[model samples]
Target: MNTASWGSAGRFGLARYVMAAALARTADGGAVVAIVLLVTTQGGSGSLAGFLAACITAPHLLGPFVARRIDLADDGRKVIAFACVLYSFALAAAVLSYGHTPAILTGLLLSISGCCGPLLTGGISSRLPTIVGSDQHSQRRAQGWDVATYGIGGTIGPSVVAAVSSWASPGLAAFCLAVAAFCAAWLVMRLPYSAPEHGGDVQNVPSAWSTIALMVKDGPLRRTLYMTMLVAFSMAALPITAVHMTTLIGSPAASAAAMTAAYGIGNLTGSIGVMLRPLRGSPDHLMSVLALCVIAGLFAVMVSPTLLIAIATFWLAGIVNAFFFAATLAARTEYAPAKGRGQVFLWVAAMKITAGSAGTAAAGAMTGWDVRIPLIVGIGLIGCAVALSFVERSMERF
Candidate 1:
């Protein structure tokens, strides 16, 4: 292909692939929300809700190992496509069993579906650089697109599930999820194979722990991973805050849904802003600003007497989230060798999942106390993250 034709074809391909990835995320998020709501309607408790959340997130902790396996495999595309099919099956099964069994079984199925999340994310992310060729600018733009897809998927997915479940049944939501996964698998199959530049022999593949150990020894990657974990922890406080608002407003379901929607809006806006102006500063500086925005936004949400004010703050926080996400991904990609990209991203996902689960659990435990406690803790965590940015800066100089 000529240069112009190749660039055009590549851009079109990337768009198609990204849209498919976004749809998969949308299905995943939508299915979780639908399942939770379905269980609640069938008399599940708040504690059960917490358990369901944990199940969905627990798979992230296993992502590192999955990514390592993908890296060692000769056909990443086939692995990703198969995972997508498995994910579709899991969601379909969960929907089928929604009200037929105990809440625990439903949670288990959802957890299994959640395990595919990191694979989808890592697989798509690793493909982007190759699709965009060597144009650093376009690659950055692609990252922005990825963030936008995530935010948009998150926002629309729940709305679709809620609507579908309401109009038909929760099982319908699973059908939607199946469609998404199928689309993703199809798109991935269409892409030309691009092997990792820093290829490694399958016989000499490193264990997950050893891969993580290597990542931690790299100064920039370690700092970026730490920041990602802190961000995840801070974001975890959103659900806690939503719970508090629901209690205070005397409309728990309605309030939770609204707040979640608002947070998604913030994320979407942030992603768009990053696309408009990709970061020019060091990763530490860029993330510090985003952290500060999150801290301020959290404080605003905590004290807001009206839901409108809370929504506004959350929207701003979402913008910060988008910027930080793009910066972090770029930094991580830069720090890791090409061969290790999948493993690095997986490690980042693992840390975020573990920290987020802990944060959520801690928030749940504090339910008897002031509902705002988690928000306060969230602020503190963001501050600590900001402080860590400075530490990263200092380490960079060495």
Candidate 2:
């Protein structure tokens, strides 16, 4: 928070953190796509591709446990750096073992990498408060940039995979992810060390279950986490639903790409909006409003008669969703105790990922019946979020 601390070195430290976090995120986001492509190219079935991807993601369930270790570490950055290095090596090993070694071996390697995935997401985010200090303005500014990395990774990660796969081999493309993660590790090592407040001593850290109970017992945090899961449930289905909608509307399948692209652009725009003019009012209220707007946008997309209308609506929904994401981050920062902040972030993120995976699977199963069904399902999920928001608000009156 001190401008004196934020000298040239501090500015560069922030830059390094951004770059490292972004690269790590790109690797995390692209790993599944690369695995799918690599496995399929190696004469494996779609089922194998899916299995490998699941193998990589299943370890994310350990996020809470991972965060406990991070919170207890004397220097959390060292833990993150180590995780990045381990992740990079595991990915590289998986690529090498795909064809030459046993299939189960490769899965094990990927699962090892997946165990470290939380450090790239929630783990990195937990450190932001420490890095920027307790200054509200600085925290908001840094949070905007930190949130932007997710959008950037979402947009660029797959693109990088596609480009690399086309130019070289799928194995090479997968290996590139390893390289990116390694670069992130190198960058992480350069960051100024800042330990979590009241988080250094082993005895000071509470149990992960305590954090979970806190999330449930705290009104705003509970509402925020629940809403996050609800939104993720719907948002995760978008890709499958978008492709299905293209089929139903008699549009080219490539139109799905346009719709997703629009959504990505909208997300980036919203991140920039956060940086330029951060949202006003309580993060809890802002979350509710932004979620409602997302619901409206999704409803518009569902009723759209043409592909262009759907694309535009998707973009609008994306913008609102980005703001919703920022609100959630703010809520966590405001409500979570310093001792368990890492666990709070990681557990919340783990829940989101798990919910998203379930939603994706549900959409895949239901889309064959009718495209509208998935969109309806998505809208219904957001409706639950809105209802939860109102319920939380009303409970405060009592």
Q: For model 1, name the residue pairs that clash.
A: 266-318, 267-318, 270-319
lDDT of 1 by residue, 52-124 (tens): 7668767867877788766777767787888788888887787687668876797788788778777777656
Off by over 4 Å in 2: 2-10
TM-score, model 2 to reference: 0.96
Top TM-score prediction, candidate number: 2
Off by over 4 Å in 1: 1-6, 42-56, 97-111, 198-200, 203-205, 243-257, 303-307, 395-398
Residue 192 in candidate 1 has what lDDT? 63
User: Model 1, poorest ten-residue lDDT window?
Assistant: 1-10
| C-alpha RMSD between model 1 and the true structure | 3.3
State the number of backbone clashes in model 1.
Answer: 3
